[model samples]
Target: MSTAPLVAVPAAAAAVPRHVAIIMDGNGRWAKQRHLPRFAGHKAGVDAVRRVTRAARALGIEALTLYAFSSENWRRPEEEVADLMGLLRIFIRGDIDELVRENVRLRVIGDHSRLAPDLVAMVDAAVARTAANTGPILAIALNYGAQAELAAAARRLAERLAPHEIDEAAIEAELDTRDLPPLDLLIRTSGEHRLSNFLLWQAAYAELLFVDTLWPDFDAEALGAAVAAFGRRQRRYGGL
Candidate 1:
């Protein structure tokens, strides 16, 4: 019962980003342009998530991180936030089987303390189900903010490690992306040029790409183009 698309490009064929993060933006704008409700654009954006995920795996990306819901998004209208959460639920329910079949693992970053009890449970269960899969990783950031993550890491490490043992290494180990590969390429759709507090620490050396295409219209071709751009960049990491 899987409907995943086929990918013909092998990972070895190009310099694909091993760890790619995308800020899925412009859902509301995409809807507004079409004279439809914002929820429709979000629903279409979910389809883009599916397509990009498949493309990421096919291109041999080790991990794909998506900016799903941010902490600041809670300030939106109550009905809109609820609809977005509902779409997330539908996405997981519809795509879990396809992900499992493709041997891809699912992970959700960010704190779940404020989420509904049942929704948190569902996320936990999905992560558990995909934990043992030995394939590409799909990370979704829900209610995540880089500043909050850094603050939490600092607090946790301060309590766990003595001041003498605390350093950049200790803090990095406690970050949300500690286990994932260093971010290589960061992308934002809808012509956005800012990070918007997504992954400040991890993106220290990442190549950023901003595209005019809306999230709902982003497909494998757009993703591949971004990767190509990343491949052309020279990352010095402050070295000669």
Candidate 2:
């Protein structure tokens, strides 16, 4: 992390957010409203991912974390699950060059043990190939569930603690997001008004933004509007 200042400035002049997290919601609903298969909406959502990543990079945002798949999603119909995984494979195979060209670093955060070996390999390749990129870091949360993450963090802490090393800081340090900055802003689209267990620990102080646009339709303009709204708020961090 940089030692740069967090000086407050006019909303228009404020430095772009260092970290932004998004819950890509409403894909199935979007497709339903259009009388299309849910997978179609998911596919459309992928295009939105490309657009928002470019916009975030252009705006100089340092990190963008997207909730691509949650652990709960595994309970859905097997066909839908298969479709989503297929899309992920296609993305990894076809999008590597574009990602490298854009200087974007791709990362996957979540348990991948249950995923097919081929998909796992693809994700690893994407992360390794873009590891050196200097542009915005894009983290895709796949099979990620915040409660699961917290449990995993606790298990790690318990394994290391000999009853003397237990502390709040120690537990926090064991979290997966220890290296990432605390979330500055969290956005959820499709008019949903809940966190859905995304970034439960890391979003402790993040400003929440909700938009009516579905994931497939979310674009740069929507993002800009969200940022503008965030700029107007007073971030007290529990201080008066």
Candidate 3:
């Protein structure tokens, strides 16, 4: 019930977004194309995550939010869900040192109440381990849904105040991403042009970029291209 306001970080000079979010889509499709199990693509997508993180940091992005798993993702086969959870465990354990070494702070945004106890522990550990880092914030959206986030924020606001006190800023302050910068650019891969329930509230003024590259195939070059494209557009925010 902390009423702390979210601080907004302005983008660095020369057109780089202060915050960039990516819908890491096409893991299963990438696997299908390779004649491999979907898990293989998910595993490979981890490499892409690493690459993109590095690229964003090099590009001076202050925050990078990655859509790792959505709330609807649980509807996937039980085995697939288990596999994804296993991957989460592995990534947290295997990558924390590297993230710390690179001075990256790990932040997980979602309704983690449903997550398994062990997975939650690992997530908490990762956050704690990187809590001191001052580098780029790496936000992994797991079990996250935009509608759910908004609903939760609304509920929190309602409980904490009377109707007269609730406002856009109040709701935003209750959001999971309230600690991070406002989203500036959101990229979706695998030819998807939709938000897919990722950061809907935070991306109100963000530039959307869609690419055909699969999640696993996304690399530094692809990331650079997306940023370059973003640089070419004018964001008027509903005004001329």
Candidate 4:
């Protein structure tokens, strides 16, 4: 049985989602398909990130959250992990100035306590330098897990209030994404149909769009198509 919801929003009246999140997948698969090194695919994925970020900014998206690295990714081989970190460092150092110039606010959301000090410093520098930018927010999730996020939020909520005082609103406020707009749409590439623990609490009512295009191959056209599909669906928030 399909668990998908019926589309209620008319195509003509559909508006671009205010907040969009993406689970970038299939870098390694893309590399294997091309008979190239996995890092090659990851490098290409960085280009895709640049393209999508610029496109999203041009399209006036309020907020864009990208699932960069998950807590589970640490289980990967040390060599691959090192390559990923190197790419991240390169991306941060090479692009922070440009991001600032374009007025894009950089924000990293996830547990950074276990990260290397240098990596943490770079991430902090990016955020700090762009702290005053009033443009679109680009939130990158690193070492993030939706279940962990919810669990942490619950822990915080429990510490701040009595059981009787806790409610839906209180829980929402305690979430890591409390300051951001509600997630409107989530897109996962590489033909993935599952959330994979990305933004579970924030995506309680978000529309999901899955594409077969690998992350490295994703381009502006891909993003446009997904957004168009989103526009065609009506979000009733469980109401008629």
Best by TM-score: 1
Task: State in Å the error of residue 191, model 1.
Answer: 0.8
lDDT of each: 0.89, 0.83, 0.87, 0.86
Q: What is the lDDT for 147 in model 2? A: 93
- Please list all clashing residue pairs in model 2, or write none if there are none: none
| lDDT string, candidate 3, 1-240, tens digits | 111122222254657788999999999999999899999999999878878887787778899999988999999999999998999888888888888888999998998658899888889989999999999999999899999999988888888799999988998899999999988899999997899888998989999998999999998878878877788889999999
What is model 3's C-alpha RMSD? 6.5
- Model 1, 21-92: lDDT tens per residue? 999999999999999999999999999998999888767889999999999999999999999989988888
What ranking of all candidate models by lDDT puts the best one first? 1, 3, 4, 2
lDDT of 2 by residue, 1-240 (tens): 111223222256463567899999998999999999999999999888877877776666778999988999999999999999998888788778888887888887788757998888889888999999887788999989999998988888778787688877887787766666668889999998999989988888898998899999988777777776778788999998
What lDDT is obtained when candidate 1 is compared to the true structure?
Answer: 0.89
Query: Which of candidates 1 and 2 reaches a greater lDDT?
Result: 1
The residue-level lDDT of candidate 4 at 44 comes to: 94
Model 2 — which ten-residue stretch has the worst lDDT?
1-10
- The regions of model 3 sitting more than 4 angstroms off are 1-12
Selected candidate, larger lDDT, 2 vs 3: 3
The candidate, 3 or 4, that scores higher on lDDT is 3
User: Which candidate would rank higher by TM-score, 1 or 2?
Assistant: 1
Q: After superposition, how far is residue 171 of candidate 4 from its true place, in Å?
A: 1.5
Candidate 4 lDDT, 1-240, residue by residue in tens: 111122232245337788999999989999999999999999999888888887777666789999999999999999998899999998899888888888888988889657889999989988999999998899999999999988998899888799999988998887767778899999999998999989998898999999999999997777877778888788999999
